[model samples]
Target: MRTATPPPPPAALTVPEVMTALRLSRSKVYDLLRTNQLKSFTAGCARRIPTEALRQYIDNQMGEAA
Candidate 1:
């Protein structure tokens, strides 16, 4: 019998990670953070945005654009 497979890892994205995902500049990402549209959370000493949140934001923006 085959055993169940493990689930994939949840993507934990840093500021630079998110920027790389979207091909955005560091300043542009920080601009979104400053504008109050995009939100970020700090874990310990590091700031990270949930990949789901970023994906949702992108989907919403795409929906609006279309």
Candidate 2:
């Protein structure tokens, strides 16, 4: 009998987590948030970035490179 595997977690990523994943500095990440380039929302004192937004940002950058 084979059981089904559970799905992965949601796309919520913290500031430091996103910074590490994007290889960007904390200031740069914050600047993105401030400039509305990166989508994010507040969770009390913490902020979270969706994985989709990161993907979109990457796609936009790639498009601009061409």
| TM-score, one value per model | 0.76, 0.84
Best by lDDT: 2
Instruction: Tell me the whole-model lDDT of each prediction, alpha carbons only.
Output: 0.83, 0.91
Model 2 TM-score is 0.84
Give the alpha carbon lDDT tens digit for every residue of 1-66 in model 1: 999999885666899988988899999988887875567788998878887778787987899999
lDDT of 1 at 62: 95
Q: Give the C-alpha miss distance for residue 40 in model 1, angstroms.
A: 1.3
Among the numbered candidates, top TM-score falls to 2
Query: What range of 10 consecutive residues in model 2 has the weakest lDDT sum?
Result: 9-18
